[model samples]
Target chain A: MLKESLSSFLRGCRTWRLWTLLGWLDIQQRYARSSLGPFWITLSMGVMVGAMGLVYGTLFGQDMKSYLPLIGSGFVLWALISGILNESCFAFINNANFIRQSDVSLWVYIFQVLWRQMIILAHNVVVIVVLRIVFNVKGYDHLLLFIPGLLVLLLNLTWMSYMAAIWSARYRDVPQLIASCLQILFYITPLMWWPHMLKKHQWIITINPFSSLVDLVRAPVLGAYRSQLAGVLPLFLL
Target chain B: MAEAGDGAIQVQCLKDINLSLDKGDRLGLVGENGAGKSTLLRVMAGIYRPQEGCVKREGKTVPLLDISLCLDDNATGRQNIRLRGLFLGLSSEQISAHEQEIISFSELGDHIDMPVRTYSTGMRMRLAFSISMAVEAEILLLDEVLAVGDSAFQAKATARLREISDRAGIVVMALHSSPAIMKFCNKVAWLQDGAVRMLGECHEVIRAYDQFMHSKEKTDA
Candidate 1:
C-alpha cells in the first residue's frame, strides 16, 4: 500500500503537466468552431444562479443579497468538490488509447480530469467574485484560516480524484452513479436553502461532510454561519 | 523496468514463424499470410519481455511497432515526437534539433501542425518511420511499414531507409516481399514455433525456406 501510494503521489504530481495538456485538449475539442467557448459556461452559470437566487430568496423569505451569495458560494464550492469526483471517474475511460498503448503513468488520467474541473471552476470563479462585489458580501479578513481551509479542500479533492478514478477503472457503471449522487447531494445539501432554517432537521445537513467544506468557504465569507458540527464527520471520515 | 512477466503471447492466426535478420546487419523482412512475420518481429522487439529470458540489445533500441501507436493521437506529432523520442532515449535538445529534419523527412506536409488523429495510417507510418529513421538507434524494430502507403511514398520511404542504413544503423523489419528483403538484408533468421530455426545469409535461408515449403506442397498435393 505504501509503495502504491508513493508511486501514485509521485505520478500524480508528474501528471500535472499532462493534466493541463489534456484539459486544454478536451476543452478545445469540445468548443472547436465555437466563438463563445468557455464563456458559454460563464453564461450558463450566470443564468442558473440568477434564476435560482431569485426564486429561492422569495420562497425562503431571505434577503436577496444575502441569499444569492450564499447559494452562489455554496454551489460553486460544492460543484468544485463534486466536479472533481464526478469527472475523475471518466478520466481514464475516455483515454482508453493511452491507457492500453501508451506506457505513461496511469495517474495522469485522474489528474487530467481533476485539472479540467479546476479549469471550469476557474471560469465559474468569476461568478463568485461578481457575487461578492455586486452583493456587498464580505470575505474573511483572516487569510491564515482561509488558506488552511482551502488546502484541506484541495487535499480532500485529490483523494477523491484517486478513489473515483480507480473505482471507475474497475467498474464502468461508476461514473453515472457518481453523477446522480452529485445531483442528489446538491439537493440534500443546504446549497439553495439555508442550513439554519432546517434547525429541527439540521442533523441531516450537519452529518454531511461537504457541509463542513461548504461552511469552510461559505461561513467565513457570508459571516452568517460558522461550522459547529458539519465538518466533524467528514474530518473523521477522511 | 520491472522484472519480466511470465505471460506468453498465444498464437492464433499466424501462418508459421520462419525468418531471421543476421548478426550485426540491416535486414528487410518480407513474408505472406500466416508467415508469422510481424508476430515474430514483436517477439524479437522484446516488447513481451518473456518471463524466462530477455531479448538483448547490445546498443540503444527503437521499435516502430505501429506508426499510429508511435504517437499520441491527441498531441501534435512534433510534441509526440519529443516524448516518443525521450522514451527512445533521445535527449530533449537532440530531439529539438532533429524536429525539423524528421517532419521534413516524413513529408507529412502541413499536417504535422495538427494532432496525429488527423493523420491517415500511411501518414502516421511515414512520420513514425521518419522519426525512428532520424534517431537512427542502434537496433531498429519495424513492423511492415514499407507497404504502408502509396508506391511513390514507398519508394521515398525505402530510399530514406537506405540512407539510414548508409549511416551504419542496424534495421530489422518485417515485410511481405522476399525480393525486398533480399535486396537490402544481409542476413536472415527463420523462426518456427517462436524459436530461431535458421539464421544466416538472407538469400540462402530464404532459398532453403522456399525449397522446404515447395517440397511440403508437393507431398501434400
Candidate 2:
C-alpha cells in the first residue's frame, strides 16, 4: 500500500499538465456565469480584512498601523492552510467519476484539489498586497525567505491531503469532524490575536504547530519573524 | 466476507477469480446481476483493486465502462472530446488529429461547439463513443455502454467496435446479449457468484450458460 501510494504521488507530480488543466477547469466551473468569476474571492477577502481589521483592532485595543497588516496576512495564510486541509477531505470523493472510469493515478485528484485551492489563494493575495501597502510593513530583506516558506508549506499540504483524502474516503465523517476541529483551532491559533496575548503562557501557542506554520508565511511577508528558527524548524523536520 | 470499517460483515463483491487473455484475444463476459461481471472488468481496467489475486496487463488499456467518463458537462462537446481522449491516454496532437473525424462521426455538427450538458443523452453517448473509439490502444475494455443509439446508430457503433477490435490486441467486453457476444468475441468467460463457471470458445461457453438458464427456468415453472 505504501509503495502504491508513493508511486501514485510521483506519477501525479509528473502529470502536471493534467492537474493544471483540471484545476483551471475547476475554477471556471465554480464561477461560471458570474461577472467577476473567481475574483469574487478577492473581493470578499478585501472586504473581510478591511472590516475585521477595524473591528478586531478596537476589540483587541491595538494600533491599526501594525494590527491591520498582521491580521490581514495572517488570515490569508490561514485560509490557504485550512482550505487545503478542508478540501482534501473531499478530493477523492468529488472525483469519483474519474476514479471509477479512468486509470489515472489517484494522487492526481489530490493534487488537483490542492492546485485549485492555491489558485484561490492567488486571488486572495491581492488583499495581502493592498494591506501591506496601506500598513507600510517593512522587511524586504526577509522577503525572499517567503518563497522557501511557501514551498515547505505546500510540501506539507501535499502529504496531508494525500492521507486525509484516503482516510476521509473510507470514514465518510472525517470531513465534518475536521471542519469542527478547524473551527476550534482557529480561535486557539494566533491569526486574529497577537502572540503576546499569551504572555508567559506563550508556550501554548509555541507548542501548537499551526501557529508556527502561520508565522512561517505571515512573518516573512510582514518583514518580521518572531522566532524565525522556532517557527520553521519543526516544519523542516515534518 | 470482508470486515467493513463499522465492524459489519460485508460480503466481498468479487472473490477467487482467475482468468487471462493474450494478444489477438477477444473475450466476452456474461453473468447474472451481482455475479461480478462488472467487477472483474473493472479489475482488469485497473479501476478496482482485487482483495485477493492480482491482475497484470502488458500495454496501454482503455476502459469504456461509462461513455461520459472524464467529460466536463459545462465544457463544449469539442473540449470534452479532447478531455476524454486525454484520459484514455491520447496525446493532444493525436486528439487534434482525430478531432474532425470524431465530430463528423458523432454527427454533432454545430452542437460540438456547445456545452455537452446542452446535448441530449444520445448525443452525449455519440460524443463519448466517438472520442473513446478514436484512442488506439493495446487493450480495450467495454461494459454495457455500447448498447447505445437507435438501430442506425447501433449499426455505426458496431462498425466502430469492429474497427477498434481489428486494431486492438486484446478486447474484454462484459455484455448481456448473446447475439452481441457472438458478433464480437471469439472467447467467452461465464461468471457465477464471482467465480468463473465456464471458460472456453464463445459458442461453447455461452451455449452452456443458455442451457443452465433454460433448465433453471423450467425448474422454477
Candidate 3:
C-alpha cells in the first residue's frame, strides 16, 4: 500500500503541466467576468486584515504599529494553511467524473487543490507587502528562513491533503466535519490575538499544531520568532 | 465489486473473468443491461480495481469512456483542446503541434473561438470527438463513443475511428450494435450475471446471442 501510494504521488508530481494548467484555469474560470480578476483575493484579504487589526488591536490594548503587521502576515499564512485543509476534502469528489473516466493518479486532484490555494496565497502576498510598507516593519534578515519553513509546511500539507481526499471521498460528511473543526481551531490559534495573552496557558499554543505551522511563515515577515521558533523546530523535525 | 452504504453486503459486479489481449487483437463485449459490460471495461481501463484478481497491462492505455468528461463549458474550444490534451498525458509542445489539426478536423470554423456553453449539442460533441481522437494510443478502450456528431460528420467520425483503431495495438470496445462489432472486433465475449457466458469468434458468439434474444422476445410476447 505504501509503495502504491508513493508511486502514485511521484507519477502525479511528474505530470506538473496538467495540474498547473488545471489550477490556472480554475482561477481564470472563477473570475472570468469580473474586472478585478484574481485581485479580488487580495482585496478581500486586505479588507479583513484592516478591519480586524483595528478592532482587535484596540480590544487587546495593543499598539497598532506592532499589531497590524502581526495580523496581516498571520492572516495570509492562516488562509493558505486552512484553505488547503478545507478544499482537500473535495479533491477527489470534485473530480469524480475524471476519476471515473481517466486513469490519472489520485494525487493529481490533491495537487490541483494545493496549487490553486498557493495561487490565492501568492495574491494575498500583495496585502503583506502593503502592511510592511505602511507599518515600516523590518525583517529582511529573516526572510531567507521563509524558504525552508514553507518547504516543511507544504510537504506536511501534501500528505495530509492526500489522506483527507481519500477519506472524504468515502464518507460524505467528512468535509462538513472538517470545516467546523477548522472554524474552532481558527479562534484558538494566534492569528488576530497574541500568544502571550495566555501567559500561564502557553501550553494551549504549544499543543496546537496549527500554531507552529502558521508561525513558520508568519514569524519571518513580522520578525517575531523568539517565542515560537523553539516550539516549531521539533515539529519540523517530526 | 462494490459494497453497500451500510458495508454489510458486498455486491460483486464481475467474477471468474479470465481474459487477455495482445498486439493486433480487437475484442468486443456484448451483454444485456446490468450485465457488467461497462464494469468490465472500467476494470480493464484501471479505473476500478478488482478485489480478487489483477489486471496486467503493458503500453499506454487511453480510455475514451466519456469523450465529454472534462470539457469545460465556460472555456473556448481552443482552450478545451489544450485542457483535454493535457489530461491525455500530452506535453504542451505536443498539443500545440496538433492544435490546428484538431480544430480543422472538428470543423468548428469561427465557432471554435466561442465558449463551449454557446455550442449546439452536435457542435459540442464534434469538438470533444476531435480532441479525443487526437491521442495516439497503443491500447484504446472505447465505450459507445463511435456514434457522435450529426449524420454528415458521423461518416467522418467513423472513418477517423477506424483509422485510429487500426493504428492501435490493442482495442477493447463495449458496443450494442452487431454491425459495429463485426466491423471492429475479431473476438467476442458475451457476459451474463458477471460471468463470461460465451467467448469465441465474433461471428459464432453473435449468432448464439442473437438466437437467445429472439427466443426470449417470443416468450415474452
Best by DockQ: 3
lDDT of 2 by residue, A10-75 (tens): 877887777777888889888989999999999988898889889989998999989888888888
Write candidate 1's Cα lDDT for B159-196 as tens digits. Answer: 76666566666778776567777877787766554445
Badly placed stretches (over 4 Å) of model 3 are: A227-238, B1-9
Better of 2 and 3 by lDDT: 3
What TM value does chain B of candidate 3 have? 0.88
How good is the docking of model 3, by CAPRI class? medium
- Worst-scoring 10-residue span by lDDT in model 3 chain B: B159-168
List model 1 lDDT by residue over A34-81, tens digit each: 999988877788778899889888888989978898888777787788
CA-based DockQ, model 1: 0.18
Model 2 residue runs over 4 Å out of place are A225-238, B1-6, B218-221
Model 2 steric clash pairs: none
> Per-prediction interface RMSD?
4.2, 1.5, 1.4
Candidate 3 clashes between residue pairs 3 or more apart in a chain or in different chains: none
Give per-residue lDDT, candidate 3, residue B115: 91
Off by over 4 Å in 1: A8-12, A143-148, A201-203, A217-238, B1-63, B70-96, B114-118, B131-140, B151-221
Question: Where's the lowest-lDDT run of ten residues in candidate 2 chain A?
Answer: A225-234
- Deviation in angstroms for A11 in model 1? 4.6
